[model samples]
Target chain A: MVEFKEVEGYDSLKSELKSLEKSDKPVFVLFTGSKDSSGKSWCPDCVTADPVVHASVKEKLSEGVFITCQVGPRDFWKNQSNPFRTDSKLKITAVPTLIHWGQSNRLVEEQLFKRDMVDMLFED
Target chain B: MRATLMTAMIRTGAKQCCPYAACSSSRSVAYYSKSAIDTNSNYDLVVIGGGSGGLACSKEAADQGARVAVLDWVAPTPHGQSWGLGGTCVNVGCIPKKLMHQAALVGNHLADAAAYGWQLPKDHHVPHDWNTLKNAVQDTIKASNWVYRVQLNSKKVDYFNALGSFLDSNTIKVTDKKSEKTITAKYVVLSTGLRPTYPNIPGAELGLTSDDLFSLKKSPGRTLVVGGSYVGLECAGFLKGLGLPVDLMIRSIPLRGFDQQCANLITDHMSGEGMNILWRCSPLEVVEAGNDQKKVTWLSDDGKKESQVYDTVLWAIGRQPRLQPLNLQAANVQLNQKNGKVIVDDEERSSNPSVFAIGDIAQGRPELTPVAISTGQLLARRLFAKSSRLMNYDMIPTTVFTPLEYGCVGLSEEAALKKFGEDECEVYHAFYGPYEYTIPHRSSEQCYTKIIALRDDPKTVIGIHFVGPNAGEVTQGFAAAMTCNITIDQLQSTVAIHPTSAEEIIKLRITKRSGLDPRAVGCCG
Candidate 1:
């Protein structure tokens, strides 16, 4: 359910960018450590994100492109959309994130797991 | 000039005064009268209970140039236990319990270190060192006690490490717990705290109360915790975190009188942590399981039978004020028949107005450590330093440290509905996933926030309820808002610290209402 854009080596990120051109939507990518030191692999958080992401994609056809980017060895804050790039704004602390493209193509509405806002996405 | 200086100099109100003999007052004659003149062994103020309230009052009264003596049962370290000062909170209850609980959390965090690719060696486990931790906790108590002792010495106020009881309208009788010596006082402040009692269930003798668990030898095996309180659930969760199998049994929903939904969520989260929950069951009896084991039996609804076997059983049903030994009946002090807590008025004075009670002994709706500490400080200000302002015992916040955390301020939705007509109030709520839960590192639990408001002008935010990460810390600021008469707009203006649990108190805005609800959004996640 939880998805992030994979950025393996330089080629993998380029391929992800190339693949996004065919979609009539915007895809947001995120990277977070998935090791035990972070907490637990089957923690209530780790186990649930996948389903949350999967449900969102399946429930909304109009929803833009969503992808998963598992952490590869040697990841850092070098990514162009790194939250620290601006001015230490957004204060991106923890993950199980829900990042979305904003009104502008280059900007993103990257929120940590917002169950409240997620519920609002699907209304009666 | 006199009025202005007196008002200006009374900053922290006395807990820093010299005793009457040593403290010099510029206009001592103006305030003195035949009745107010001190005689041999007479003091302007005498506070009982060296716990929070008594200690604070003693300090303040000394600062106010009032002769004071603090009579407390500053008991010798119990056999197989430790003590220093800081009363029950520092010595026996809150501080030690929190440290043990936090230690358990460290182990829980270390367990999943592998998922983050940090190759921790096999011997990385931090097995709880009971003796070491107990010593550390005692050291803290000792340090705090020394601080109090030094404060008293500096002020030259009298301090008695003994028990105090009311002998008359203003005089008190004291008997040293260690020695048979007796002393008397002029005016008394009663702040003896509360102690837990066992149920009348058969075999209950085999069960352990909190006082005994801190000295537990072997880790609990198949532990059975009876009571649906934060205490029972929290201990159950902590032991579970320490690799013990636990069963939590309660008569009703855990944390009764709280927001019903939060109670449900907290229990669910505990259950998620692998605890077995047995609800609608009250202990009826206990029997020996084996030479080394114990069995607890309970009656479900309509007399159905259920029994559980365990190596350890803990009871967290309730606590009673430690009032009996004080010989209160001799003084005709009113006690709450329902729970045996001494009844006190707005001024913390009993029906016998000369006698005053605070802490757990004084009957109150919520019994929390922070409230007790603050109440103690306030009582000392009025009694010791001669401050006139009294504390209002309303809108206090409390948090239960169950595995799944939750707490609230002001009235709960159920209580609010009863106080105001249900139709005349509004409830705004938000149920969402926590950003923390989304991280690949935490548990898969979502958070819920609920707000209660009167359906009137300003839509005043009267009650706030939260069940999630740091619920206690989050609700503290919100509680201040309610105390300060903060309207919905002022609360809106209090800029929320982003990515923090506290921010949830303000982030909620115009939310979808059930009907004519006037309340704003509730930030819970």
Candidate 2:
């Protein structure tokens, strides 16, 4: 079974990742737009990819940590100097960007929407 | 300071007569001192050259539990260009060339998009910024270099960023910027590949070679590419495709060793695409003409001297093995005097039995990256893994990335006919167009494919040739089939997926012996 955690900001995401740094299990981090009052993300791609990422990760990861980072409202993310955008390690250029921590595997935008792409990412 | 501390610890540990069981750190120190005490530290295998072949060999040997060391260092070109670990193919050859070729193809597609009802701005020509493409290509190369290094480290293979020269048959003196050291090995493998050769002409240094072109910061404006080697043709093709005015000056023939027909067609296609082709012309000299341009002098076939002014001059005449630096005489390694490559036996063992050579540096071996890599791995296996398999150098498929690419395996039509005699060889060919070319109306005349086979029953295919879009992709499968000794009957039985450039290969039916037009008809037939 996979352990799922949701983080609201960049600092929380970093702390979550730091806690799992020593883990032998595979760690995957997903960055997406935060949900609003209606439970829909401001970023349309994140809204479309939300179910697919959770479903695929839950099914594929037998034992690992999958962190979903909901980077605050559009105004904060839209700023060029946002930590999510400026951080060297993260370098999140787009919403709904999935990264396999400590590895180079990454999927962004519509890539997360494809079942095969998600399957390959998780399977590998 | 760290070296002094380590030496002191070793002496203290020795004086105390501490057993390895006493401490883990001391145990590791004792193991390290055993090798350090012996100045001529030995390795199971030492591979010189860090290119595709050298790296592959070192990794394979290490995987087989042999202590392997690979020494790789790149000497900068005259233009002061140097690259990291991964050799020619990754840094300057295939990777960058293919990217630039694809970039040129994308440029062409942009122009063609309007024909497919694309709402592109009217009469707006898309300009290709050379630096943008160059930087992207360099970044990709750097990433590959890092990956290769990581792979070597993970495989437990020691990599030396140093130049290796032979002290003896099994001893090598490896030198780097900081220090020099001699390492002896049970076996030494020399895979130092070839470098671009410049013609012996006055002011030759004024021209750039393939080594310099990939990393060039500025756009190669109106250019004259001298020589008809695949390198010259490919550079000419891509430069012209990239919207540069490119002139190709051929001394005698284009693609001298490849199929003459395919070579002619490739040049013809480039010529049709607005590139100037100067046949039977040899360059005399290249001199600076001021304003960041050059005045190139050439002698024509008609005993006439001609001159042209161009912003860039590139020499793609040929490549020669870089053997002088290795000091073959010191190791008693013999070379083929005609060409500077090392003379090696079937097992790639040079005159010095303790030493072996592979890749382009070995005499009569195909100078291709894949060939070098395979040979390297095989040599390692034979040396360490108790494998007796010799690297097969037959039916190796290769692709020349001209605007109209040429990919083939086995004999050329001329070679097949000459070897099998006129009556024994049969050729089936076709001129076909890809469906995608329909709307864009790209010329289909040079888009061709051919099969050379025995004239007997079953007609076992001896050669496969393709000239079209995705030639490499189309020919790779056939290369495997050729390895299986697939015949015409087998090929004809296998159905092809329609609407692909590759399908044209399977649809080949018209024989040159039949004297009928080999032009393609509708897809249904």
Candidate 3:
């Protein structure tokens, strides 16, 4: 089983990113809705994409680092000026955004559900 | 001296270390450094209220590298109903209202669809299911609440589900059912927003406000809406559209701040849609009248007394700012005596230099969601990004979600005439039918559009008003044009898209001053 590291919120993501930058391994950052006390994401899309992305990350990208960055709840994601949406390094427009760090390719929203796309994202 | 101490403490990454922690003699220093060294005061910015403005401001501030925390709590309504995060817009105000309005619109479209040659079974009787709509709306709100929580967490903005009150200029005391804690920040924003106010009449508790009406489980059968404000009109309009018998009681005129002519047209459209409007009447009392019904007694302008029984009585009188609970005196934030709203400067800074107010809580600003969001974002940018741009309160476009929607931007006709003399201004208007309405043979009597502009050379457009289908969609582009200083000639010179209600704006030639019949003659090339 592929072990995926999870970090809560933007500050933790920033700290995790800083640590990841020091490593030579390929970085895969998946921006998702933060899980509630019920252990479920508010984003239905993220809920659907989470397991598929996790399984793919574990199988194909064994050597790569998988960082699941929980973007805060619904209202925060809906905000137009959110760092997840506006940040140059990670311009996340939708939930369940999978990005191969420093790469041009990214899968957003429903694309995260496709195992082929998840594999393609991991391959790069 | 205190500033230097704070700077040194922040620079040295000192936590839980205060020189004044043991010193009880110097009260000011102890108080200041106590907050500075405390874990709660670690935040660079603390925003109160998780409404549109507060949430936006908090996220933006956090994005700009400010350690931020947001505190939000929903006080139960008089009817003992409360909602989750995302404030009034998401929970009770804009989102649910718009959805219910859309549901009512779909109801009308179904009737229109039948008229459009769509055959239905003879037994097909489509009735409005209140529970289904109520559940759907609540579901959406719940989803939004979850999203807000996730977003706040993801952005690194600490979310405190507690009611916040000022303990000092830089420190706030947050209390929930579980416990109480003190949070301190370098800067604090007050965006607590507002709540609907009820009349002080006898047995008024029997009535419901917009806050409770949206989440009510049962159908609001045979409703009576009081007040002439947009809230009352919209609730009455949607209720009537849902095929319920609705009566609206207004003390005087309708739409107090909008153009009277447009307001009259809106009321006329509502009347045409079977809304019984009682003008110049005030509610005297509401009493329970057996079997889930309430008897509403009212007095007319001429002292005529009347009573009616209704399943629901919605009070849409007006909204009051949520400042009382914040204990403004504790923070020394000045409020406008007349309106009880926080007084703010151009930068939305309150009387206390470190405190700022935005959205509906700030006096003399429009109480719209977009306005609040924009102001919040701009305020954050100015604070953390070192940008000096201020929020522009002028020419903000707003749409009333009446059955025949009304949308307007810039100055109203009365406002324009009052500002600049009648001779300096000219008004162009037209009554046109939507193509879809023609197919259904729906009366287009209330469908109209008007543009108010200066009579001088180039004739700069001052106000744009439209009363028809999709008024919001039609007025939004015109609002953008008005921002560019668009003139009557510029508006007319632009080629229009054929067979659309919005295109009627570009073809407005009959000036209201000319006394020419503004009615459309025919569909001509």
Please list, in the order the candidates appear, how each scores on TM-score for chain B only.
0.83, 0.92, 0.93
Q: How well does model 2 score by local distance difference test?
A: 0.85
Q: Which regions of candidate 3 fall more than 4 Å away from where they truly are?
A: A1-124, B1-40
Residue B425 CA error for candidate 1 (Å)? 2.3
C-alpha DockQ of every model: 0.01, 0.04, 0.03
* Whole-model lDDT per candidate: 0.64, 0.85, 0.86
Show the lowest summed lDDT stretch of 10 residues, model 3 chain B. B13-22
Candidate 1 residue A13 C-alpha distance from true site, Å: 61
* Tens digit per residue, CA lDDT, model 1, B308-364: 788998888977776766787766788989888888877776755446777777887
lDDT of 3 by residue, B1-525 (tens): 335544544554232222223333454445446444655566778999999999999999888777899999999998899988789999988888889899999988888777777887666779989999998899778757766765676676888889999888888889987999887787799999999998999999999999999889899999999989999999998888888999999998999999888899999989887789999999999999999999999998789999999999999999998678788788789999988999988889877756899999998999999999999999888766666689999999999998999999999999999999899999999999888898888888989999999999889999999999999999999999999999999999999998899999989999988899999768756
Q: Which ten residues in a row have the lowest lDDT in candidate 1 chain B?
A: B26-35
lDDT of 1 at B417: 85
RMSD of each: 21.4, 12.7, 12.2
Best by DockQ: 2
